[model samples]
Structure formats: structure tokens, C-alpha cells
Target: MEKPQPVVVKVVTPEDREEAYRIRIEVFVTEQGYPEEGEIDHYDAVATHLILVFPTSDTPRRAYGTVRMVTLPDGTGKLGRLCVAAKLRGMGAGALLVRALEKEAKEMGLSAIVLSAQVHAKGFYEKLGYGFPDGGVEYMDDGAPHVKMAKTL
Candidate 1:
């Protein structure tokens, strides 16, 4: 039997926010070919950002995934920019990031959490309890197809 990797997800501190950005760019921009222009947006300034890290004795720590929650006008938390390193995709990193944000949203008294999930990743989000609302439609974001989904908290 093998031991599971130690994964820690935390609120990104002001100084460490850049680490989150780096992970986002590495996954979204560099690996997925998303234009760098719109990767970081105005919402990021006010949104609560989370960073998922893998800690090892060989080094202090390394950020492996990231996600953010932006409170919408309807008071629902909007989950966006979820990115986990390509190498760590199946290691449960993305789910950890989403769960961390869900915990934060619940603490903030949010009724639900919404997201525009990339079409291909829809099943991943679905397994986490997010679903498309009535009349939800596919939309384009950053040159990719996305559909809106929400999960009640």
C-alpha cells in the first residue's frame, strides 16, 4: 500500500497571491492556450482566492491548484478560474480547491455557489454537486465554451 500525498488548501495571503496567479497561468494560459490578456480580472481584487499546495521536506511548499469565489449581485458565490497543474489533475487537487472555496462561501453566509464551467470539465463539476439551472445556456469565455452551473449551500 502507498500513502496519499499531503495536500493543503488555504486562503492565499496578499503576498502569496502571485503564487496562485502563476499556477493559473501555467494551467490556463500556458497549458490550455488561453490568452494571458484576460486571465486576471477586476473581480480578482475583491474575490477570495484559494491556493492548493503540496508540502514536501525537500522544499517549503509548492502551489499546485487555485480557485476564487466572487460574491455576485444575487449574493451567490461565483466560482471561477479553477486550475490544477496538468501533472496533478487526477490526484484530487481540483476537488480540494473547490471544497475549500465552498467552506469559505458557507462561512460568508452564501446561499449558493455558481460557476461557468468549461464544457469539457462539466462532468467534473457535476460530480461535486454543481448543476445547470433551468434555461442555462452555453456561453463563450476566453474563447472557450462554458455553461453555467450552481450548487446550493
Candidate 2:
């Protein structure tokens, strides 16, 4: 059997931001029922965005995943808005996106990375070495339960 081709990940440029936004809209807004207006925020202007693309010979490269990272005032990296195209979930695209974001965080000299993970994906973040804070607190965001998870770089 042929191995699947690896997806390419890159820091978003002016041209690529739209693709990242599109994927986020599909996952967070249309599919997950997040508020359309709240799906975007001021952070988008200052954050560093990442995009994952699958290459093809017959058609344009397809954008399948996205995530954004922002350096917090306390000097850690905050990762958010991570999403993979529905058709590509469970195929390693999400992991690839997280790895890319972690590398970017390291390159930015961040001491740690933190994220508010949806409750359903807590195990997924745990597998990637992120863990909830001591005492295990949960909070609600946009009506969905979430936990704060972090990993030291």
C-alpha cells in the first residue's frame, strides 16, 4: 500500500490567511455552532497563523488545517483556533498542525505554550504532553466546556 503524502505546514502570509480563516470558519462556526461574530477577534491582527496544505498535481493545493499562536504578556505562547478540515481529521493533520505551532513557539523563544482545549479533546492534548493545571478546573467558552492545558518548552 502506498503511504499517504505528508501535509505541508507554513506560517501564514497575507495571501494564506484567508485559507486559514476559511478552515476555522468551517470547523468552529458552521460545524461546531460557535457564534459567527465571535469566531474572529482582534488577536487575529497580531497573532501568527499557521496553515496546513495538501498538494495535488491536478488541482491547486488544498488547505486542510490551521492554528494561530500569540505570545502572551507573561512570555508564554498561547495557541488557539486550531482546526483540521473535517474530511482530514484522524489522518495526522491535527498533530502536524500542533507540532508546527510548537516549533514556531520555540523559535519565538517562548518558555511554555498554553491552550484552552475543548473537553472532548482533552485526551488528544494529553497525548501531545499538554496537561491541565493542578486541581483540574473546567470553564465554559461559547457554551462549550473547556480546560486549560499547557506544556513547557
Candidate 3:
């Protein structure tokens, strides 16, 4: 079988922020049943890299996936609000975005990178070398269970 083409990942520009928001709305709000407010939280307007992924297409490109990274006060990088569009999930978009974010984190000299992986996706993050912390905290967001996972940069 022929391989699917790769999605291009990049740091979103101001002009692409709205497109990123729309992608998040589709994945987190509509598909996951999260409230509109919950899906677009305060951090979105603050310190973060709103990463956007676009597939090579003939027509106007669409936002395929996105994730936000924030530098904490202590210098640890946190990845959150990750979402891959439903139709594009198996095309490796999510993994590509994560790898791109890790590269950004390394350049920032972050001590570690952490994220709260949804329970169903813990194994996915595990495959990326992230693991649950010993005293890891768990919580539910919009009814989905999540636990903290971290990897040293």
C-alpha cells in the first residue's frame, strides 16, 4: 500500500490562530463533548505555541491537528489541548505534531516536558516515551479521565 503523505507542522502565526481554534473546536468541543468554554481556555491567549498542521492538498489547505505548549514558571514545558481532526487521525498527524513540539522544547532549554494524557491515549504517549509519574495526579476534564505524564528533554 502507498504511504500517506506527511503533514507539515509549524508554529502558528497570528493569522492562523483562528484556524487553530476551529480545529480544536471540532475535535475537543464537538467530537469529545466538551463545552465551548472548556475547549478554548484562558491559556490560549497567553504564553503558548499554537502549533498547526496542514496536509498537502490541491484545494485550500485545512487545519489537520494542533497542540499548545506552555513554558511553566519553573521552566518545564507543558503540552496540552492536543487534538487531531477525526478524519485525519490515523495519518500520523498527532505523532508528527508531538515530535515538532519536542524540538521546540529542546531549543527552549526546557528541563522536562509534561502533558496530561487522556486515559485512552496513555499508551499513545507511552509510545512517545512519556510515562506516568509516581505520585501522578489524575482528574477528569469534560468527563474524560486524564493523568500526568512527563519525559525529560
The best candidate by TM-score is 2
Query: Which pairs clash (backbone N, Cα, C closer than 3 Å) in model 2?
Result: none
lDDT of each: 0.84, 0.84, 0.77
- Residue 141 Cα positional deviation in candidate 2, in Å, after optimal superposition: 0.8
Off by over 4 Å in 2: 1-4, 57-61
- The collision pairs in model 3 are none
Model 2 TM-score on a 0 to 1 scale: 0.91
Counting clashing residue pairs in each candidate, in order, gives 0, 0, 0
CA error at residue 129 for candidate 1, angstroms: 0.8
TM-score of each: 0.89, 0.91, 0.85
What candidate 1 gets wrong by more than 4 Å, as runs, is 1-4, 56-60
Q: Report the Cα lDDT for candidate 2.
A: 0.84
Q: State in Å the error of residue 41, model 1.
A: 1.3
Tens-place lDDT per residue, model 1, 1-153, is: 565464655654654588888988998889899889888999989989888775555343467888898998897999999988888888788898898899999999999999889999999999999989955689998778989999999
Tell me the deviation in Å of residue 110 in model 1.
0.5
The local lDDT score (0 to 100) that residue 4 gets in candidate 3 is 51
